[model samples]
Each structure stands twice: as structure tokens, then as C-alpha cells.
Target chain A: METDLGYWIIPLAIIGGAIRVSTPFLFVSLGEALTERSGRINLGLEGTLVFGAMSGYALAHLTGSPWLGVLAAALSGTLFGLVHGVICSLPKVNDIAVGIAMMILGMGLAFYFGKPFVQPVAPDLPAISFGWWSEIPQVRAALEVNVLFLIGAALAVLLWWMLRATRVGLTLRVVGDSTDAARAMGLQPAVIRTCATAVGGAFAGVGGAYLSLYYPGSWNEGISSGQGLMAVALVIFARWNPLACLGAALLFGGAGALGPVLQSVGVSEGYYLFFAAPYVLTLGVLIATSSPTQAMTGAPGELSITK
Target chain B: MPFTSLSRRGFLTGTVAAASASAVPQLGFAGSHSPLTIGFIYVGPKDDFGYNQAHAEGAAAVKAMEGVTVIEEENVAETIDVQKSMESMINFDDAKLLFPTSFGYFDPHVLETAPKHPEVRFQHAAGLWSEGMPTNVGSYFGYIGMGQYLNGITAGHATTTKRIGFVAAKPIPQVLLNINSFLLGARQVDPEITCQVIFTGEWSLAVKEAEATNALADAGCDVITCHVDGPKVVMETAAGRDCFVCGYHANQSPLAPEKYLTGAEWNWAGVYTNMVQTVLDGGTIDNFVRGGLADGFIKMSPLGPAVSDAARAQFEATKAQIMAGEFSAIKGPLKDNTGNAIAAEGEGFAEDDIALESMDYLVEGVIGSTS
Candidate 1:
């Protein structure tokens, strides 16, 4: 019996997998970038992401509309972000500590609420097939991209423009760079930071929705596998640039797909090692970019890590 | 006259109870004096439709008993957290027996905690408990490879492409055994049939499982099955791609009814109930207990509507042979995928063979590498 074992399947599989896997990463990092740019870091986006995935899946299953699920997820994420922002706005409260607490709370709440939605199938987000020109099935499957991913790609560009070319962008940059300067400028740093964090959380929630309502497409307790936390590292790797976040997410997704792609083509040597590609890439990028004597470029001046 | 008669009846009941208590002093510790509290801890959600769910079903069976009270904790990590859970169940819940149903919980979590609570019994699933381990700690596992072999038979008949796929979590011995058995079962129908396997490297990565399933479908594998913790994603993904699916760990027919083939399901309910019953009757279970279909440790899911009559007949016949100990999945004259000899001619290994436990290679007709 003849088998279609060819080298061509490797590249196609990886490309398709990267697009599919990167959607959540793209959103989470973009959200994290927005939050960090306002001099606050929401490390609890992992929890927010999971909660969003759960709520999004549940609402989609209940309403029979995938778009409604995304909206519900975004709303839940906004609420989670607002809570984080309000709590961090208190005097003497540490943002990192609050973020950690919020992460646990968010995950716990998601698991509790997500129990009922695990078995039911929610409406999935639609995909636009770009492989109509190709006769090959692999190519068609590879080019069949989810709409959420395209939206994420477009959001990345929009965020880049807003952060660089808008009046709101300048205020955010000023507040992130220096608190005293913001106070002198008559801008309430706490209020601006809180609002930024809330919006960032909304981005994360959408990312979660993509996980449960599109790719892999289910509401399970283990749906989000640290993609939320990895976005934190990815934000730094991208220099807090939204466009860079998009590229970095795709890169991570490709690295993640490397193991399974090779195995598909009967290349199983160092298979487990290939699964670690994303984490290794993250560590490698972080090590390569770090400098002991100076703050990281593009890092917010008032960001707690830098301080 | 009524008071005198009631007193006489109470005296007779007391005499009988005292006689039985003295006769079975061994049962004095549990179930006789109070309800037996059995604690169950899972590494994931109880309704995951995979490994944890199978064990949770077992716990449910134990829960249904007369003198048994079951306590359950889910989503507990396989770290010191499990140890804390075991300790809490022992102290707070007064649990006398614990089933930490994750392989990772055995090494230090169960080993360290078992010695501290010498009176409490700890039975871990899929862990190899040796002689040197704590006397109170034991291990139990089902030879689900037999079920996988049966799954392969059904998959082989269902496949029009003559190609099937297996999405696995790791290349561990147990997983490798399942993969080999699945392929071997298919080869029984048509020796020309081939299986391609993809390992996702984690037990519960939903996205990776989906990607692997798609990769297989793209490669033209019409019948797909998996050994992941949760087969829900794989089943759903395969069904979405219009591929026939064979399930693992638990019944996944509800997830994909139309495309569903039969599945390999763990029958832990019987095992758990029997263990609890033994403890209730003042009998002790073995330190290391293992069983296959014959012993009721594992079972095959009902054949779905897609299974052909020929396939059903073969499955039932093979199942009967397995139950009667007349057949084995790993037979003689077998070779690894690399063309290396795995078994000499006339050398067959039964389901309980220790040699089968250290499997490090994929069988012939399986297009994948163990390394």
C-alpha cells in the first residue's frame, strides 16, 4: 500500500499550526503590552484568559451564536481586569502580588463555572479558506485560517498605531514613563493605569474565547496551558510592541508545532525536545536581550519590574 | 409483658453481635464499627471524559455501597499538594483508604504520606509498587492494551483509506504498548493496513491534540484514535474532519455519535467496589493487583452504529478469546518497526508479562518512532 509520506507535508503542517496556535498568544501579549504601557502589569491575565474561555464557551453554547460568546468572554475579561485594577489602585498594594492572587481566583472561578460547559459543544468561530487555489488537501487545510486569528492580526496593527500615533497614546506613554511627571501634567496616574489594565484584560478574554470557540474548540478545565503566563514573557520579548507581539506569537506557535510536524513525517528523533521549543525560544530570547547595567529597551520607566 | 419481651430481644441481639465481633477481630478496625471512608483524588476534573473520569466512575460505584463513604478531591496537582490532600482526608475526613488516581502521585506523594499514616491504605493507579515500598501502599493497573487491540479491529474495518492514526501523550512504555496493540489488531484484519502515530508530549494539551488529529487527517488517515488523558478534543476534531474515531479511557460516543466507532474503556467501577467490599468483609487486597478483561479491570465500549457486522463478529470472538486467556496481543514472530526482532517464534507474551512493561519500540506496520 502506498502512503503519502513526503517532506512537503512538514512545512504546510507547521504553517497551519502556527496560525492556529498563535491566536491566543497574539491577543494575550497585545493585552499585556497595553497594560504594561500604562505602568501596571496584569500578570493575572492567565486567570482572566481561562475565565473568558469558560464564559465564552458557556454563553456560546447557551445562545448558539459564536460572536455572542466572544462578546461575553470579552465582557467577563473586562470585569476581571476591572477588579484587578481597582484592587491594585489601593495604597501600598503591590501589582505583582495582586496579579498572582487574581490569577488563582480567576482560575478557581472558571473551573467552578466551567464544569457544566465541558460536555456541551459550543458554536465555533468561522474560518476563511485561503487555499482554494491549491488542489492539495494539506494545502487547503493549512490555508483554512480562523477569523479570530485574522482579527487578532489586525488588532495588533491597530494597537501599534494607537500606541504611537494617537493623543491617547501620548498620555499612556507619559503616565507609564513617570508617575510624578503625570501628576505634574494633571493626569491621575492611578485612574489611567486602572482603565488601561481593564482594557488589557478584555484583550486576554478574547484570546481565551479563541481557544474554546475556535482552535481546539472546547471548554475544559485544562483548556489554557500557561499561554496566558507565556504572553508575559512574549510581551517583554516583543519590546512591548504590538506588531512585534504578533510576530513573536507566530514564531512561538511555529516552534510549538515543530514537534508534531516532525512526528507526522516520521522524524521522531529528539521528539520531546522539540516540544520544548517554545519555552527554549522564550528563554533564549530573554537571555540574548537582557543587559545587567541598563534597563530593557521599550520597558516602561514606571514598570515595577524595571524599578 | 411488652417491656419484658423487648428486653429479651435486645439481650439476644447483643449476644449475637458480641459473638460475631469476637469471631472476626480482623474486621474490627473498619466498616464494622463505623462507615468506611474512602478518599479519591484526581489530577484533573472528574468529568474530563478520560483517565480521571474512569477512576471517578469507580469512586462513584464505591459511593453506592452500604457501609462505604467516599470523599473526592479533583484537580489536585501531583506534587506536595496531593500529600496534603491525603493527610487532610486521613485527619479531617477520617478516611481509612485512599486512591490517588494519577501516576505522578505515587513516587513521593504516596510514598511519603503512606509511611506517616501507617494505618491508612494507599492504592495508586498505574504506579509500579515494589516490595520495598511502604507495606500499606499498593498499586493497581488494567491491561487496557487488550481493549486497544479490539479498538484497532473495529478501526481497521471502518477505515476506507487503509490508514489509521493514533494521537498519544507520550512514548512511555504503557502508551507504546497501546499503540502497538492497536496496530497489531488492525493488521489482523488486513496485514497491509498501517498506523501512523503522533505524540503530543503532554497528557491534557487540548490544542496540541487537535493539531495532531488534523495532521493525521491531512495525511489521509480515515480512522483516528488516541491515548491522551482527554480524548474529547481528539474525538471532536476527528469528527469535525469527517474521520471515524475510536475512543480511549472512557466512553466518548456522546461527543461524536455519527462518526464514533467502539472504544477502550476502563471498568474501574467493579474494581473499586470489590476492593471496598473486601475491606468491609475483613479481607485484605494484594499489595500489587493487576487484571485485564477477564478480571473485569477493563472493558470495551458498545460498538457504535458504524461498526460492520464482520467487524463486530471478529471483535466479539477476539474478546471471548482474551477473556478465556486463549489469545494474546503480543505474539511470536513479531518485529519492531526498525526490523529488529521483538519476539522469537513461538514466544508469546500474555497481558501480565513483565517483559511487556518495558516496551521501548514501535511494532511493525506502525509508522512512528519511539525515540
Candidate 2:
């Protein structure tokens, strides 16, 4: 309890918390950023996320391998994304409504099929000790990072790099910026969008795998607790940039940790208010960034929300 | 697959509705012995492996009885949707007894529907039956703190560090009471044991629960427990950290057999059977009931491998004393976290004491403030 760095542990804990809690946010928003970059919006990722969690946990329990569980989750997520993509590609179909329908379908399927997997313990994802740098056991435990977190961070950077540098990325950008131009250049907007959504859905599935196999490491009806939907808003706050998604997710995680952090330091007087820190910070971000007078500079021109 | 059966069931239900409306009065009469249908509503997935699962298991037990039909629904929120579901149970299924098993369902949904179906019986979980509430409604709850108190003994001895941790959903009296008992039990072995508690402000947030679990473990709590809707997050997170876990709601030892010390579980199967059997035997159930360990309302899971033999024996002795009616976990001679007297010395309160129901203070030895 004695320390020269007495109160600084709060910030350290928050940083550790941010890293621990933000993997799902990072993955889902990165996925969303990818999908939105090709002029399609998949609001159904929430359903995809929960379904992925269910699939991942169940498969992990059955296969006794956490890696296989992640694969199954991604596959199921891709299936959800494919269905959403195909349905929304139809003439006169509203992508938002289709997304909503997909959400319901995905959740219903997950809950109906996920019954037996609820009580079983899925194999845990391996952890790497980044915390060895600290001598304090508490600090070491706090900093003991999950392997999936590092993968998500690396994916974020790779995704940001690919969006600007790759051929496929250029095609996606052209499709997102202008449909008429994309068609003139021999690009199929629907095809590119569907592929983008499928990719997005796959990433979401991995995020959910992180939920059920790594962090909470259990499958239940209430497991997701709106983390998937929160990622949608987080994507918006990140301005559809994959690299920014990482920072935004960590920020959100830090905000989520604020209440618990304060209480840990013996400041419990306003802990209840700290529960709202994430939403409050999110609202603050949205207000500061979003204005009627200003266009979303990074937004895809055909993106549904900004349009 | 369901469309054809759905229409056929709709026709059957329509006819049953007509027959039931006319037979409602006669069905409740003294000589009536018509076969009965009962309904159970849940606030979460039926197989949530936690609170709702416990209720569903009890309902399943009721399903095995002869001359009774059990109809159950899951994931039904305590909103207007519950009113409609209750109406369907009465009209379509001809269900005479209904159990809307959620704390939030008591006020508006159950109360509003209770007046319209006076001939039916309503058994609500977490019901507060004041003078104004319906007389046909009965409230039932278990004192699970005794089990927590027992579980804490194993945790108390199992802890290499004097610091223990609890990840709770909210600071409700029921939850606060359990935390106090847990600490008191821990202090029984090691008086210097300090419990760190963090409330997530919501019932079932897995992310927050994981983060809280890690935070508690990092803060040096070797033995961690929880009083959330589900202890899945706490159990898995703690086990992941190589920390010993004490579970809640149902027996969660199965989740982490090696790491689990013991669990506080609700034995609703026996309780539900007893309640329904009374109704089947032409007895009324319109009373508030609270049962302790002896009554089989609250039970403890078997001690896990992590617990030492001495701790297990100590826990069993305390359990035996409770079952023999010689011990009460909520006894006085206690002080709140703010150093206020909760129970004066020699002024012990029983486990079922009403004062324990409204417990708003943290007991001494708890590290965090109640607020």
C-alpha cells in the first residue's frame, strides 16, 4: 500500500483497462469501417457480434480449441453478412430495414441454438505477458494482455495501410465515393459492397469471439450487453478510419473504466456517475465532430447515415 | 416448419379461450378438480446458466408432475409484453396459476393483470405485497446469504492474500446483505480480511464484469466472488487470472472445477414443487414466504478441490449449525462500513429478519463504501 507513485496507479489501471476492454470495439469498428468504405452499411453487426459470441463459445467448448472457435465465429459472421448483403442488394430494398431484419434473425438464431453452450466453459485464448516489465504484481496482472488484442491492433494498422495502398482498396474507395463513376470504370457496386460487408461481418465475429472466449469467457443471453451496438457509434466517432478506430475504442474503454478506477483509489462518492462516463464521452465526441455546417470529411459519399 | 402447427394451435386456442372464459368461476370453486395448466415467465434466456436458468429448472421440475400442464416462455421483459403474455396464458392456454419471475414484473405487469384475472393465482418472485397489492398474489424469495456466508469460509481460508473481492450488479439490500455476510464469514477465520466490492450499476454486463474481475485480481484479491445476475464473467475472468472463484445463483463449480471454492445456489426445484403441490391439493398460496438453508430454499454447492480440508470442515460445521437452527449469519454486534451499529452485541437478528431485507449499509471489514 506504500508507494512513491501513490495516486498514479489510477491512470495506469485505466490504461490497462482500456487495453483489456477495447478489443471487441476495435474489431467491430474496424470491420464497420471496412464495410462503410465500400458504400454499404450493416447495422446488423450487433446481431452478428452476439451470434459470433455464441458460435465461438459453443465451438470452443466442442472442439476444445479456442482457435477453431474463432474460425467458426468468423464463418457464422460471414454468413450473416452475406445474407444481409444479398438482401440489401435487391432493387428498392432499404439497407437499414434489411439490416434490422438481419439483426433479429441473427439474434434469434443464436439464442435458439445457443441453449446448451451456456453452462460449459470454452477454452480460453492464450495470454502473453506484456506485464513482465512491472515489478508490482498488481501492475503485472493489469498489463497481462490478451493475444487477440494485439492482433486487433495490428489489423487496424494493416487495414489503414491497405485502404490507401492496395488495388482492392482503390476499387472500394471508388465505389464508395461515386456509384456512377464506379460503373463507368467497370466496377460492380453491389459486389464490392457485399464483399466489404462480408469482411466486416467476419471481423465482428472475431470481436465476439474475444467476448466469449477471452474476456468474460462465457456464453449467455446477456453477455454482449450492447457492446456491439456501441461499436457502431464508435465507428462513427472514429470517422470511418481504421487507425482512428483503435484510438477511439481505447478511449471508450478508458471512459468505461473511469468509475471503477476512481473507486479503486478510494473515491467511491461519485462512482455511480462514473458508469455514464463512456456514454458521456461518446456524446461529447459526437457533438464536437458532427455539425450541420460541416460535412463528414472522411465519410463515404454514399454512406447511408451522412446522406 | 411452424406455420401449419401455428394455425392449428390458433384454432384450438380460440376454442379454449371461449370455454375458459365461461368456466373461470367454476374452476376456482371448492369442488372443481379439472386438470390445470400453469405458466412460468422468465426475464432472460431459459438456459442463461444463472438466475433465469434456476427458475426454468424449477419450472421443469413442475413439468414432471401428473394432471398438470406446464407452459413456459423466456426472454420476456417486464414491460407491456408481459401483460399480453399473461392474458394469453389465461385465455389461450387456460392457465390458472402464473409465475412472472422477475423483480421488475411485480409492479405494473403482474399487478395490472392480477385484477382482471381474479380467479387465477399469481406467484411472483421478489414480490412486495403491501396492503394495496392484490391478495391473490403471493411473494416468495430465498435467503441465499447463508450460503454466501458458508462459501466465504472456504474463500476466507483459501485466500493467500487477506484481500477478497466481490463484483456485484447493484447495491440493493439483497446484494448488500450477502456481501456483508460474506465478509463476516471471511473475518471469522482471518479478522483482518478486507473485501473489495465494485458495483457495475447494471445486472448483466459481461465487459464490465471482466474488467472488474481483472481490476479486483490486480488489486490483490486472490479469492473473488460476485452477486450479479450471472457469475459467468467473474468465474471465467478470475479463473483466467489463476484466482480462486466463489460462485453465485446456481452451482457454478462446473465452470471452473479447479478454481471454484464453493457456490451459493438457489434450490428452487424443491421450493417450486412444494408450492405447486399445495395448489394441486386445494390449498391456497396467498402469503409471503421466506425460507433459509433448513427449508431448502438456499443451498451450497459441494466444496471444490481448492478449499483446504480444515476450511471445508469449518464450512460444513457452520452449515450444520445453520441447518440445526442454532446459527444466523445476519447477527448483530456488527458495525456498518461507516462505523454505525447495525446490530448491538447479544441483539442478534435472524436470517429472515425484516431489518436484513432493508440493509442499506456495508458491514465492517468491507473495503468500499456503500454509495
> Chain A TM-score, candidate 1?
0.97
Could you tell me how far off, in angstroms, the CA of residue B229 lies in candidate 1 after the best superposition?
1.2
Q: Which residue pairs clash within candidate 2? A: B333-B343
Per-residue lDDT tens digits of candidate 2, residues A14-92?
Answer: 8888887899899899998998899888889899999999999999999999999999999999999898888878988
| Candidate 2 lDDT tens digits, B1-371 | 34574477568777765676578955544235657789999887777667888998999999998778899988788788887788788867779999998878988888887887799999998776767788888889998888889878988998877888898878888889888889888988998998988888877778888878877776777898998777877887788778999889898887788999989988889989998999899899856888888999988888888789899889988888889885777666888888888778788777877777777899888877777
Q: Candidate 2, which segments miss by more than 4 Å at Cα?
A: A1-6, A290-292, B1-34
- At residue B179, give the lDDT of candidate 2: 89
Write down the worst ten-residue block by lDDT for model 2 chain A: A1-10
Candidate 2 docks at the CAPRI level of: medium
- Model 1, position B278, has a per-residue lDDT of 87
Considering only chain B, what TM-score does candidate 1 achieve?
0.89
lDDT of 1 by residue, B10-76 (tens): 5765675577669977754444468889999999899999999999999998898998789999989
Scored by TM-score, the top model is 2
- For every candidate, what is the interface RMSD in angstroms? 2.6, 3.1
Instruction: Score each candidate by Cα lDDT.
Output: 0.90, 0.85
True contacts kept of 1: 0.68
CA shift at B69, candidate 2, in angstroms?
1.0
Clashing pairs in 1: none
